[model samples]
Target: MDKYDVVVIGGGPGGYVAAIRAAQLGGKVCVIEKGHLGGTCLNRGCIPSKAIITSMKLLSLIKSSSSFGIDVQGYQINFPKVISRKDEVVLKLRQGIGGLFKAKKIDLKNGDYSNRFRAA
Candidate 1:
């Protein structure tokens, strides 16, 4: 079994950032992420919310375009399209962060674990 200098339990912003810093300092690091890379921030929480907010802002701008003296009408917000775009943005950012982790040579493990230590 290979022992790492550091083992991080989460892949959230804090954990992943710590792992990267440790690796930069020449320490062998491994990150255990039961969920997707970038953790909640980049996976299901912050990034998703930000993307949705972006869509909302865009929709608002379109709806209020006439206020800016731009002649526009029949503007509609496609909820499904907005959601799809948000998912794409989140996925792209997640993959980019994952690539960064890989470039830093941080071992990323994805799976659920319990309190079980088997004897070899």
Candidate 2:
């Protein structure tokens, strides 16, 4: 059995950041993440949506270039490619964040803490 000075329930910005801070201060820390790291912000909610929004903005700019006297034509937005790229970006950032946590020596558990730990 292992002991930790702190155990964080979620891996969202708040939880992970707290875990890292505690680890940095020399407290043994463990982060239990029910889903992919970066929580909703990095995985499904914020980062993914932001990536899509940015792609849409870029597409709009390209389409509207002629209005600014810039001759751009025959450009088509490939929806599949856009989605794939967005997924790639999100994955990369997630991995980077996980790496940061690893560098800090924070143990990352791949399941929900509530299910794994029973409150005494």
Scored by lDDT, the top model is 2
- Once fitted onto the true fold, the runs of candidate 1 whose alpha carbons sit more than 4 angstroms away are 116-120
Candidate 1 pairs with clashing backbones: none
Expressed as tens digits, the lDDT of each residue in 1-120 for candidate 2 is 678889988888999889989999999999888898788888888889999999999988998898999988788989999899989998899888789888999999887457567554
For model 1, residues 3-116, the per-residue Cα lDDT tens digits are 788888888889988999999999999888888878777878888999999889887888888889986778777899988988999889888878888898988877865453
RMSD of each: 2.4, 1.4
Whole-model lDDT values for every prediction: 0.83, 0.88
Off by over 4 Å in 2: 118-120
Superposition error at 59 for model 2 (Å)? 1.1
What's the count of clashing pairs in each model shown?
Answer: 0, 0
Best by TM-score: 2
lDDT of 2 at 46: 86
lDDT value, residue 39 of candidate 2? 82
